[model samples]
Target: MSGQLEKIRGLKYIGVVELASQAARILAEIGTTQDRGTVSEMPDERTLRYYLAEGLLSPATEKQGTASVFGYLHLLQLLVVKKLQSEHLPIRKIKELVDGRTERELERLLGLDAKAGAKNEALSYLEKLLTSPSASSPRSQQFNSPAADMMRPVAPAHAARQSAPQQQGQATWARVEIEPGLELHVRGDYAPPTETKGVRRLTRLLLNALEGYRGNMRK
Candidate 1:
């Protein structure tokens, strides 16, 4: 479990401030900052301490003399937690989701790699969020069997509408189609999750909310 974090390759040990800064730089570089004309929520040193205390994050990978040092994976972990929080997920749920997740999994979840900037992979990931619902064929047996009766894309819109506590007063939207011409609107400064699990989680929330709609239309 602790083996993957033992070595960070290039970085020997980074103080808490440096760790947060590096994470911020990565977020900014990935274009999460440019989208809203400001940087997204970044965990500061104090927030990092709180996360570590709550076990939401892994321990620092290494140490330098008397100072504890963090690895690259630590940086990735911070970003992952931040992304999950942006979705309004509770810390307990976020902790559950990220616990024991490997370095590769973390980077993939964030849709980043060493080649991202050159390849514009971040932009590509954004595109995926828009098209993921449409890419999956709606289950033919929807509402037929319990297992198949889940949210199926009927008319996922290009954008959704909802207000947010994250970015107050700024209208945000995440559109998920529940049925044709009927869509779920999540308003806030919303950025669609770039990972599959996050997408599924949101889909389930939308699906549950539409239960009344389904029940009413029962034939």
Candidate 2:
């Protein structure tokens, strides 16, 4: 794994941090140490290669080495992809969903916060939070089912509403579609993500909240 990692780090790229070797080691450790949870197996080097080939993991940063180096964003992406895989999501589908999206976008899709800095700490934080007991809700479990069921495009506005936490004394006007037969009214000046960056951040917030909702549903 280390050798393969070293080789990849030798690739040329611009603006890449010089932490290629360290990033590779951290990734390897994560691969080896992740708990199975509901997942069958963790991804290995071969899997990483396939992801790289499929354009799922893009590491285009500057470094002094002969190869391109990866940065915190890349590390976060690897962690997200691995977690989704553990949910038994097929690589083909995962690739399809995330292929064109940037790491910043994927981070938002996974509902990660913007507090992303520090490669190792950020990666560890995401892994710990996503793999904790709360991550095992019915929604996450659904990822273990057939890929066809998990491929629906999420409705942003509705999803944003569904995943938000209700709080008292929040004054704003909001419209929410409850179901085919029912719609609800709320008073709050709630707005969904409209900007490119806002959309990603909103998506991440929704996903995290939705996971909690699913867990609650199972109780």
Candidate 3:
């Protein structure tokens, strides 16, 4: 139902030039550049490939590749970050600008906000690509299922903890159900169970897992 979901479902083959143009336009609209430049300056094929390897532009996988005009998007984000830095916008403020706007709306702002939008879009697109049927194989699907299945024991763990006496000077543990069949056993040595900190730690762990998964997928 989201615009990103729609794009992922409906996207077909788009030319490299067309992709570049679209990315450029979005960046320009978001105010990534003060001069309102076009995508003409985007790197050529070889340079773009290098950029992708460097993680400047996220590399497209086979199934959801779509000819990869990500270089333009990356460049736009960099330009916007630079512009925002020059304007003395704090990181939080810049993040707020990006978080508050849709991709199209951010494009209209044309600065740090636009850069934020670009980064968000790139990440979204990457997720779609990674999750698409074409990007994953049967084995990967199986691996993912086990990871999901790990959550089943969490409810019992929570129930057991409820009946147990709280121990002093012992690490506290929480069982979190991330999704159906996926649960995390979060252990912390600090006093006062701050759910926020647990969630942050879990999120970081998941991100690290995803990064490794992506790397393995690439290989």
Candidate 4:
């Protein structure tokens, strides 16, 4: 029992060290104020400070000389904040959206890939945040609303199609029924059963419709 407990503690320590190493690497490569500003498109120094003050960004892990050194998590937060603001989402709302998440959890939510474009990934990440249960703000337009609840997934009608193969036709737009009425049509010749459109537009439509319908309900 003591051996098992010691092993668990050692593994936890190793995980923390691994995270610290990755954060350090991220900082060493692109942790400068100018670099962060350029990458995130948030050039104003005061704006970064405001985000820090508002608890939108986690504090630096360590300091180098005079300036504070930020980590990969901080970089991720900055990118997400910048992208949300470009969409005209309020700062307070953005803060509300990201609060109470661990660094690793936030990374998972953002779907952060070192190879992917930061802005595009951030935009993609925002959709997931809106749908997430953590978005508990009453002002949150989607998720938990009555109209949002009304839209449900349609189940398969039959168990299987045990019939002869049908003749193939010229490829047309690939369609995906995200909900009963909502769909995403992408112009492509993708093979059958392959994912045609991802959750991008489907997520947007659901969120927009929820907000739109909710406003109408109030009036």
Q: Rate the local accuracy (lDDT) of all candidates.
A: 0.60, 0.51, 0.45, 0.48
lDDT of 1 at 185: 60
Sort by lDDT, best first: what order? 1, 2, 4, 3
Worst 10 residues of 3 by lDDT: 1-10
Off by over 4 Å in 1: 1-9, 33-40, 113-219
lDDT of 4 by residue, 6-124 (tens): 23222211122343443334434443324334344433466667777777776665765655766545655765565566556787877765665565445544444344546655766
Candidate 4 CA-lDDT value: 0.48
Scored by lDDT, model 1 comes in at 0.60
lDDT of 4 at 124: 61
Query: Which candidate comes out best when scored by TM-score?
Result: 1
Best by lDDT: 1
Decide which is better by TM-score, 3 or 4: 4
lDDT (tens digit, per residue) of candidate 3 on 10-61: 3432434444455444444444444543333433445444434545443443
When summed lDDT is taken over every stretch of 10 residues in candidate 1, the lowest stretch is 153-162
lDDT of 1 at 82: 84
Task: Give the distance in Å from residue 215's predicted Cα in candidate 1 to where it truly belongs.
Answer: 45
Model 3 alpha-carbon miss at residue 27, Å = 3.6
How good is model 2 by TM-score? 0.34
TM-score of each predicted structure versus truth: 0.45, 0.34, 0.30, 0.32
- Quote the lDDT for 63 in model 1: 79
Between the candidate structures 2 and 4, which one is better when assessed by TM-score? 2
Residue-level lDDT of model 2, residues 1-219, one tens digit each, is 333433453443232233333444555564643464654344455655666767677645455467555655565566667656756788776765565466555555444434343464457657764554324355764433222122331244335445674543433333344322223343333344469999998778766875696569646
